[model samples]
Target: MNIDLEDELAAGMREHTADLKPSADLLDRAARRNRRRTAAMASGTGVFALAAVVAVAMTALGGTPAAPPVEPGAPPAPELLTVAMVQERAVAALAADDVQHIVSTVDYRGKTEHGEWWFDQVTGDSRITRLQAPGGAVTMDLWQLVRDDKLTMTQVFHDDRSYLVLERPLDGQRPPGPAGSTPDELRAALQRGEGYTLVGPEDLAGRAVLHLRFDFADGSDELWVDAETYRAVRRETVKHTPDGDARNRLEFEWQPRDDGSLKPLAVKVPDGYTQRQVPPVDGPM
Candidate 1:
């Protein structure tokens, strides 16, 4: 009996459980648990994949990226304005203000002379009142009026008793150049100029302005235009001379009437003055 005890126990245990089988409910529960674990693992993997895709999409769409930190104390650069843009703005501003009053002063050969100009853009009429030196010796006050394509000049002599008046057609009486206080003339001069440079912003007569320099064949021009209105405020012309340079300056101040009409400019002939009429010529008079 001692010798067969281990073999007998093994045989009895096998025979007792020979008909055993798992219940259907238990099998179903095990399958459901397996499916749930599989579904949860798939969901977690999908979430990770979706997160990666979203990050890639944001980068592709140029989403806001981190900016490099800027230095603590740096000044920004000033904006640059072009010459053509300034000229265009100036021309537009001048055209909007159709009337202009200009005071020009010329200093040459130790002589200083003052001139006044009135220009009407709508009527194309102008008046110049100045002192002229005909032969470089005597200075006489002269008034020049341009109306209806005609020029009339009245000169008051030194004695104040004798005066001279001359009238001529203006078709070819003057050379082809900037002939008025209009900004169109300045724009044209800038277009035909050889060298153009922006001298930077400056203060002229207590007003901010842009300083522009242009060179021509015989002379050069320095123009100061208002920063806000883009209108010409002052201009200086330097003419090359054998002895020295002759500087001519023009200062413009616009006076727009409250009625939106041009101011009247009167030029009258002196009493008992000699009148002379010049015959119309083809070239400059």
Candidate 2:
């Protein structure tokens, strides 16, 4: 019975993996990378296990918990970066917006290991109050948990389901965009060209956090992260569009995620509009 269940589960995962669209896989790769960045900026260590736990909990619970337990080795409470040194750096960086410890997001349109140069949207939310596009225009709607640093997007609807979200995991690091540009992708993006800039750390909203900025010729991105858990306290973006600058700011407050993957929290939508989950694609991963 156990063997059969395992087989079924594995088969399901495989089918999901196989049916995933390239874009969703790219987003998933970016999410993993951002989480790692959050971990690094906060803890100075890569703790995939914690992320896995949070992921499972979030997926199962359908909403992020208000508070999550702190493992002994985990970064201290009131700070999410997970490291003392990183916490200090975040505090210092908070004094100024430019530098701080962090995990941030960016959109890239350049060369990569895949030999495919295309436009990719990347999001790295950490301990900050808001995120804006480079031109201060175009705010992306994402899945986030304000109580804990559980921020990610399972699905994104751009103008009534025009664009969909998908995700996947790979054996090695990936590069920017088209199904693989994530933190793992960063390893390769760095190899392809000069990667993002590491500014330093900072204090945001009375909390010490890290900050990192990535600028491309097209536009720029910023990240504010929690020093203890490496979770996003706030993220902002300024987008450069031919029309004008569009801005978006996402704020998070410390909460518990004892339930699961921080999602399905209250969504702030415009009046007379509604939020709904984009149905799973007909096929597998």
Candidate 3:
């Protein structure tokens, strides 16, 4: 939007303002919403470098004389969004009003796994599925459902054609993952984006998003968040595990819960699959 706006603005403007930059008000508007660190953006690295952009845009557009230069080492004004604020918004994505859907990809040790998870934050009900190496093969499946105030978990291993069902009390058990997905667990993976820097605003799937990058002790990651909703949209990370460097990509969407949406989330057992008394050595998710 800024780029297109700048182009259109430059076309109709006079030559004196040809060097005009983005509006300071626009940057401030974004900052108010994003809550980025004021100190960091002062370096004029990203779009928040409003000291130069605003001065140039305002002076040229207003036809005013340029201001005198500072003596030296003047502090730069700050504005723009940051990772912490976005994560805060995304962490609240588990609003009881609707269901949260997450699509995740994990690439590790020469194999790739794709997963989809759906969970009711308020009700603590969820359905999680995984496909290993594609080709329509489901490696793992799990579902937690609440019926008549009783909660139950069913775990399935398609390769072994076996499943385990256990009745669980709905007290304080948190959602488990790589099979289970929750907003808090998902946010924890990003470590609250401790030192992320802005890569600028970008468009993903026709939706406006903010891109941020960070490096941790063992790896680095890129996170994308919805500009309007402030929910997590996508993530890409490369981490050095004991085995090797693992790469993963996660995508998210918020869906309105309805009967139609429940069809796919329902637990289904194949006609010939056997029910097991115990889970695999890896344990139940």
Candidate 4:
């Protein structure tokens, strides 16, 4: 595992679990489900190989050939897709603008894990697009455009002051801020063909994936891709910050529905956390 990949994975773990605070009813159900899954993963049955490429490609079919390589550090030259192309597909997939369910968990001190997210998307010209957490404390404030998506944070029943700006738009691009937006940007960054080395293909939990190592000034990232589909499946990032060494890991499993929409059916959140629905916007505001 490379540094970048480790750091990213850790970050994903933290980000995914940062806020729990759910109701007892929701918490009980979530904890029961997560414990079962976590046990499955920790069972260590050598099932990681089943998750690499085969599982990802079996979700949806694509029309592209093999990708050169898009890991962190090695050769900077590779045949990759452009940002525009990636976004085009994502946008088309999200055109209907249905709800976005975010199933996640959080880890406190690297111990127990518990969490889940279900977001209902609201589209159209409302500059104030909101991702209502169906039973939690966080809501995503998305600045939406037809061609770009930017993220910010908002508390359910509080003032806008709690808002935190996430990623901004790219130069000259005012795209819609849908669920597919940022992933599309990340895809573009990967396709730019400039910042990684190829490590060859490998297997993940019941899937076949391509492995790439990335290098940075102070650290690095290890990326896992679905070999057949050319989409990222997991990333681990490692960085040496001023405070200390930080590691983040992120794993994503997406299944494209017949409607062309991608859905995340499960996510493993670290321990000591709860996920709940955000209050409705029409309530008391």
Q: Top lDDT: which candidate number?
A: 3
lDDT of all the models against the reference?
Answer: 0.56, 0.38, 0.62, 0.40
Give me candidate 1's TM-score against the actual structure: 0.55
The estimated TM-scores of all candidates read 0.55, 0.28, 0.60, 0.36
Which lDDT tens digits does candidate 1 get at residues 186-242? 767656645456655565665667778887778888988887678889889989888
The number of the candidate with the highest TM-score is 3
lDDT of 2 by residue, 36-123 (tens): 4455554332333233333332333333333444445544333222223333343443322221222234333431111111111222
The lowest-lDDT stretch of 10 consecutive residues in candidate 2 is 111-120
Those runs of model 2 whose alpha carbons end farther than 4 Å from true positions after fitting are: 1-193, 252-285
Model 3 steric clash pairs: none
- Candidate 2: what lDDT? 0.38
**Which of 1 and 2 is the better model by lDDT?**
1
In candidate 1, what residue range of length 10 has the lowest lDDT sum?
Answer: 46-55
